[model samples]
Target: MKSISSADKLEDQKFNALRLRQLTETNPSIRAEFGESGDNVAMLIDAISRADALSKSQHIWYIDMIEKRYDDLAENEIDDIDTSDKDLKRLHDDLRENLIATITSVSIHSDNIKKSIAETPDAVQLLVNAMHYRGREELRTTAVVAIRTLCSLDSNKILFAKAEKIFKYLTRMFDFRDGLVLKAAFGTILSLWSFLDDTESNSVFTIEPSVKAHVIKGIIKLIEARCFLDDVLEFLARLSIHDDATEKMVMYDATTCLFYVLRKNPSLHTKENCAVILHAICCKKDHRTLIEMRSEEKSRRTLSRLVEGGTPRAIIKVNGILERLKE
Candidate 1:
């Protein structure tokens, strides 16, 4: 009998890694065996760690695997891919999605799992990179959802792991027109901002004026598409207070669209945010003409109805806009 060499053992491990990826996805029993809900989390993390070691990249193994295959297939540009290639692609997607699902599930389960995930070499970084990669909306959504959960505890460990990259990745998330991903992106960014220490918060998000315009306009595009996320409106209410951001908001007609949603969405959260944004733009003298022409003239009846119907904050903001229109 020939002795097994280290190379043989390595190949065996890699082979098992690939097989493990599929088994957990295709077999319900295996998936449950590795799920986060019970005692299997430790083994699950170990499996992911082994897979990441095999990948030997900044991203998770399955993501790297599928993206490479996708790149190869995309380059060919053939009308029909070979059957083997399609099967392999499906296998990679299943593994990638299931592993990401595990990561997301484990993130929300327990503080211990959160800490363990963070402790896993490059786990948090890989999750962030998954969001950064292009053309995979579901991948981005799941990874960011996990990030939101991990960051919920506000552990400096997670934030400090390539924190600048994480910030940039999330800012890019706003540019995605897919409303579902954008909504998840908004909630994730809110989590980061809600807890970031002042120094990091100021530094990480302080983009150039053009970049700020791009982000604001991106959100406006979503409103035009009628995505109308309350988190987005809430974010805008906070951000538009800054003079330059408010300027971009006016340039992009955010005030009018916000009013459109305000009249349309009866949710108190929506009402207050729209009121706040309209009021902020109203406060700026340079843009009041734009506000008057674009939003106020169209807003009085809606604002009047809101004055009698909304929360105190919304009412105050509505009254302020009406008072401006009067003057």
Candidate 2:
């Protein structure tokens, strides 16, 4: 007998969840048994949890279905008849959940659906709304995933970055302890950071102090947890390109995380990136001494270890930082 791999199990889960979602949305028997809103929220949450198992084609099909469901809800206007506050909230929440669920499964190059989502003014707002409510980490994770995917395109990045509240929402999303959410949040920031250019009047990266501190805190926590080190380190490296971000990294004790990562025998690419980031910090006019002191507690013990065991490229980068610090 063949063992079911995790991937296979996940696919099975997604299939079952999708079928259940279909049933709740269409079949009256199951719909009546669970009532209207309960089944939809449960099934939508399940679908979102298993969304990664879906293939690209499945994403497209599911996205279309989700959109149709969203449209049906809007067209029905359940709130019109059910004027109760609780009922209205439920209806509004369902509508938001539908949009979040749709965008959650949406990935890059998802064709018209991605384009439609980017073009829809309410789409970004709905994502932020889904993230803003407390105790909705899963929904927030899904929304950040959507943002991460959307930011991969320069046009979409520009569109989303223009949303005045998005920067703050993204910064707050880092407060979620979930690894997936943090990864997606960092990915979105990195994408938007890359998209920033002085040439465009509308393009900007707002660095709210508290928000920036929270983001840095989130990055450090992710590093400490050893979650998504490659992506996290890469994000730090890119963020270091800005002097303010570099200074903040030092203020937030990023050198300690970088040294810990280097000592852990990470992948060669990660080591190289770590070296580059440390080098960047060392080159900073204001924070170089602080980073150097932190990194050289035992007289360059960290850099020496990398030079001894790291790849040739890593060694060169590390040596370059050392040489620069001497100057």
Candidate 3:
């Protein structure tokens, strides 16, 4: 018997065709047999190698058949089968090379396949490793996007905790003057926030005070660059709703950052622009006194805009501030 080593040879096109046929066969025994044993490292390498050939020729038909078969199994089983066996791990490691290749392949045109590869449990780490392995800027960008998509699928606890190195790489992208990289960085932050919200597991995977401050600093740099101030301001305003004091402090820093932006270019902090910040500060009654203590011209303008707008919360805030001002 051939040893199932990590360096197993990839299967040929003919073998892939046979495997596809076996995988799609309607016979229950054959389907089970393929499901149990066909998904090994060597086979996956083979499948990836032949993906283009099969896809262009007969791969699409086989994929359709396999999808239908899996759908049927899912409907009946109602539980995800455990594919975390040792063999699967080895296969995932082997498939990492193929995934990176496809990501860099100029000819590959299937977003679904990319997404499927990203959905794998270990895929984010694999992509991160590929980022280090390939020094090409385009490949690094692709890896970051792929990792972000994968992390978006789960909580920040699992994704951020396990993928710190990738997070660092992503943060560095913000330093580049490229708009696309900046956009990707924004997406990665949003994904991290989404993960925090969805999991509710507060062990500080990525939204910790330090990380939050780092992100706020990056947004400030972007504002200084005069790149995307309004969007950044809105994001900060939205983030203020979180209950964490550290997060709230980051929001305060964001507010201060915006104030500097407004001082330099007052037009950006229009009445409409400051409403969300006003709402955020006034969410807690005590915060109104704090807002009044700032005593900056823009803060007063923001408070006045809130008052004129007649938002009940804003009205209360103005009342509190006015009483304090009177004293």
Measured with C-alpha atoms, the lDDT of residue 43 in candidate 2 is 42
lDDT of model 1 at residue 21?
49
Which ten-residue region of model 2 has the weakest summed lDDT? 1-10
lDDT of each: 0.62, 0.61, 0.49
Best candidate, TM-score? 1
Write one digit per residue (lDDT tens) for candidate 3, span 1-327.
012223244333233333343333334554333333423323443444333232233434445656676666755343333332233333433334334433333112233333444434554555565455323465556555555544544433255445656545565667767787677766777666666656656654435665666665666676667676667666666666664532444354545544455445344233234445544544444554345435654445644554666446536645565455444
Give each model's clash number: 0, 0, 1
Put the candidates in TM-score order, highest first: 1, 2, 3
Instruction: Report model 3's TM-score to 2 decimal places.
Output: 0.49
- lDDT string for model 2 (94-134, tens) is 43344354444433324444555566545555555556655
Instruction: Put the candidates in lDDT order, highest first.
Output: 1, 2, 3
lDDT (Cα, tens digit) per residue for candidate 1, span 112-190: 6676666666667767776765535776776777777676665633353345466567767776777667766666656
Q: List the residue pairs that clash in candidate 2.
A: none
Q: Per-residue error at 124 for model 2, in Å? A: 1.8
